[model samples]
Structure formats: C-alpha cells, structure tokens
Target: MSADNRIIRVIKGRRPKVVVIGGGTGLPVIVKSLHEQNADVTAIVTVADDGGSSGIIRDYINVVPPGDIRNVLAALSDLPSLYLDIFQYRFNSKDAFFAGHAIGNLIIAALSEMKGGIFDAVQQLSQMLKVDGHVYPASNTPLTLNAEFTDGTTLSGEAEITGAGKHIQRVFVTESDLNAKEPPQAVNQVIDAIMNADVVVLGPGSLFTSILPNLMISNLGDAVKATKAEIIYIVNIMTQKGETEHFTDADHVRVLNRHLGEDFVDTVLVNIAPVPSDYLDHQKYDEYLVPVEHDYQGLRDLGCRVISADFLQLRNHGVFHDGDKVATEILNLAFQVGTMKKRRY
Candidate 1:
C-alpha cells in the first residue's frame, strides 16, 4: 500500500511504534533497551560499511555488509547467551580461510545468497533468531560511502574517508562500484516504516558515514522530510575523528538539517554529563576525539526541543549513551506525541 493510503492500526494498549535509523555500536544498545521496554521497534541499519568483517564479506561476495545487521540481530534476539555467543564467535588466526570472520556474518552471507537479497535474508534470520523487533537494511545492495573533504577532494569507501582523518564536507551513498553515479535505493518497507512510525530516530552513530548515508537516498530522504512522525535525533556523546571533530551538539543537528535540506528534527537528545580529563583510553577508543560540546542556543535556533541529561555511561573506559536512560527518554517523547495526537481529535 502507498504511504498515503496505508492504514496504521493501533490496538488499544499496544506499544508505540519507534523506528531507529543508524548503524554502529550505539544503535544496538538503544534497540535492545527499546525491545525490553516493549516498544514496537524497527531498526534501519546502514549498508555502506566497508571495514572489518563486513568489508571482507562484502568484498568476497556481492552481499550487503552484515556486521551492523548481525549486531542488531543479536541485540534484539531472544535467544540464550550461549547461542548468541556461538553466532558471534570469530575464527582464530590459525584458521586462515575464515580468520576474523564472525559466525553470524557468514550465516547472513549464506542466507543472502540463498534468498537472493539481503532484505529477505534478514527477515528469514529474524524469525529463526526469535527477534522481538524488525530489522531492515537501509539498502538492498551493498553501498559505497563517498565523502567530500572540506578541501573539495573526494574519496570513496568508509575506511578511506575515515582513515584520511580529514574534515569531511559531506558524505553520500552510491552503488558499491566506484564508477556508479547513482545511489542504491532504499526498499519500500524502509520508507513505510519511516512514514508510518509514531516516532523516527536518527543516529547515535558516525554522523557522516553511518547515519547520513542512509538518509541520502532520494526517496528515503524525501519520506523522512514528509513523515508526520516526531523525528528525534540522538546526538553522539563524543565527537569523532574525520567526521565531527570539535563539533557541538548544535553542529550535529545543523549537519543533519543541511543533508535533508530542511530542519526536520523535532527533538534533540544531548548528553550533559562531563567526561573527566583523560577519562577515555585513547589507544582503545582512538576514533573518539572529545565529549560533544553543548550549544543550547543553537539547538533552540534550529527549532528543536532539547532534552539534556546525564545520558552518559562509561564501560571499559569508553564513553557511551546509557541505553536505558536514552530509551526511556525516547519512549517518553513517543508517548507525549501520541497523547497530543489523540487530544487533537
């Protein structure tokens, strides 16, 4: 059904529909928390990844990079810890052929080949994993991330763009081939989820590579702009190198607005908790530069109702958004929107 005619059936006392869009370590944390909270969650993950296990799998076989999807599945899966551990298990260096590949990636790759598409593969796997929520790849095919540096030089591939450590002007998605000028399109379900959702979320991931690439698709970007759903941006807790160094919370919102060609962000989640000097282990978390600065006035100028709190969690010396805290805030926003919608009737 077309978005215009599609019916959103809200059963009495049913969970609010929350669609989370992004890729990276943070995405799963928020999704898992939402699942536990009984929200009708849908995760739209990036397929532009070209690093580590995902990169290797995408290179060997023309399949969507499965690293982010694998993580998301594990997070929402209701399986036993031991079963998940086996799926997440990696091969030792002694196993040359399969070394460093996570078992889940292989399974996803195999399923992708069998199903003839990553989207279908993920759906089939979701059923077997007993996932509580839906997980959708932003694109059906592997996508290459292309970035333009502030100096006007352009680069292709997530690894190259990020490894260069240059200030990025913007990043967009394209077909995996470098020669392709057109971007791979997001599937209908992704658009439907965004339009039909009670609340739509973007990032706590890399602003350029992880979140923006998904929004770059023409149809997907258009749907996001047109969706009446309350769009919430979960800003990163820390600035990332080669992406948003020295960026404030407002800068993140500004970039998002610029990418989508308008200010669509209704709510902005900012972490006000301070990171102690030298708190992060640089060797372990090299990509993180510093805690993202707060610019309350700037966020206000963008017409976003800012929710600043101690959404910070420290684990293994790495700073992260407290999943439960963030999820609670998201649910509150969703409920508030729902309440307002009902009162307007």
Candidate 2:
C-alpha cells in the first residue's frame, strides 16, 4: 500500500458516533458501556413521562420529565461520587415541601423555570454534571401520552395508561397531528451525531412507552430512517405486568415494524442466557418474567440479525437489565458490526 493511503486509513479509524433514544434504566446501561468504548454518544430522551416525582414537578413547575433524565445523567457521570451523589440526593423531610423530590430533579426544575425551556435546562445540567455524552429531550412540546386498547377503551396520562388492565393496542399523543413543532435544537445535534455515527441504539426499556414514543415523533423518526446509520433494538429481559403483559420478542419487533416499518430496526438484541428461576420476582412484581419471545428464528428469517447475550441482572428494587452487562452486549454488537470504531480489548 501507499504511504498516503496508510495515513488516511489510520486517521479514519477514530472513535465511532452513537445515538441512543428512550427512557428508563435500559438506555442508560447502553450509554454507560458505549461511553467507555470511546464513542461519540448522544442520548435523545423521551419527555412523555407523567408519573412519580417527575409528574409532581411537571404539574407544579411545568417542565419535561426529569426522573428519566436524571437517571440517564447518573449513568453517564464519569467523575467521582461526590458530584453525582449530590445531584441525586433527595430531601427526606416531614415538611410538605421537598419530601420525595431528588435534588437533581429539582435542580432541573429550577433551571428549566429560570431558563424558560426544558431543553435549555438539560444542557445546563449536563454541563454541571459533566456528563460523558450529549443528552436532549425527544421533543420540547409538553405531551400527554395516550393509550388505546383493542376493545377501543382510551386512557390518558402515563399513570392511568399503565393501569388500564388491557393490552395497549396502540399508543399516540393527544394531538397526533399537532404539526408538533420540530424537536429541540439539541435533538438535531443528536441527529447530526447519528449522521456521523456507525450505529444507533433504540431500546431495552418499555417497548411502547419508552422506545416507540420517541420514534412516533414526526421529525425524529424521519431523521432515524434517513440516517446512514445502523439501528439496533435491545429487547427487554422481562415483560411488564400491565404494560407488555405477554409480549414475546417477535411481538416487540412487530410493534416496532408497526410504528416505523418492516426494516426500521437493523438488529434485534435478545437474551439467550438462561435466567435463574430464583431471579423471578413474582411476589413483589406479582408477575413472572415473560419467556424470551419465540421470534428469534423469524427475525433472522426476515433479514434482521438476532444477537443473543447474557443481558439479565438481579437487583433488589429495580427490575432488569444489569447496567454493565447490558453495556457489554451493546459494545459487543457495535464492534461485531464494525459500527463502533474502537478496540474491544
């Protein structure tokens, strides 16, 4: 080979770019792992959450969901525990004020109100935390998540939607055709990151609420489909009681295809390792871990590569997806596909 050709190849073999979309702990695990792989990462988080501490702040102070955003930021935190712990600290007081709110959530709320925009507040927080990657709201619009059942029952709000006692036949926002304004300018940065990315990750969270909600956005989905990047959907290890109910791996993919298209997700990550029966949380969660969906064969048949890994984790309060293990699988996938321009070792 020529000397100039070798220099060009060495220069081009730099770190990869990654974009992650979704809420909950799942996407954070992937982000933490990918961050270590020396990839340029962007996390486009969902703003539709309207429950728990996030809901309280959203209602009283009027801001995008901060709980999920905080979780993601913690996962991306590279510095010592001092800063991260302070941000995550919760005031446990008998007083009516600051009872259950995390200091991080309130900090975001205060900045958001002070700055007059949720996206701007998140950027400021990101800088304060010195988070490893860029994080942005999927959309700046304050949205109410709507769920419609097969029987035609309609539910509004994330809390009520989870308790409908019926399978979510379809999920959409109240103003589906709102001509919803473009996603926050920060999101376009995520898209631009994707344009330069080798691969993008979709989920390992709630299939409908966490993953699909972002894609349902008019412009976000368009950017994803148009990007020259490979997209992967990290399937969940267990199905939620009222949410997925009895969803299989194939059912999850079908739901994705329904939203984006048949070829929307390039690869589907599955858990092939045997989960210990003792890991099941029937007593607390009141539901069994739904078996891995039988759609692995079908996914491979349909032209999507199905990569299996040990993606399960046992935690006391949390559900599934061990952060480090899930991150390892993601790095494995990225390296296997040459999507991440980094050495695995």
- Most lDDT-accurate candidate: 1
Could you tell me which 10 consecutive residues in candidate 2 have the lowest summed lDDT? Answer: 2-11
What is candidate 1's lDDT per residue for 214-300, written digit by digit as tens? Answer: 999889898888887889999998889888899999999999999888998889999889998778998999998888888999999
Candidate 1 TM-score to native: 0.93
How many angstroms is residue 297 displaced in model 2 relative to the true structure, after the best TM-score fit?
Answer: 2.2
lDDT of each: 0.88, 0.72
For residue 31, give model 2's deviation from the true position in Å.
Answer: 1.6
Model 2, residue 161: distance off in Å is 1.2
Q: What is the lDDT of residue 55 in candidate 2?
A: 88
lDDT of 1 at 243: 86
Supply the global lDDT for candidate 1.
0.88
Give the runs in model 2 whose Cα sits over 4 Å from its true position.
1-11, 174-187, 286-289, 317-319, 335-345
Best by TM-score: 1
| Model 1 root-mean-square deviation | 5.2
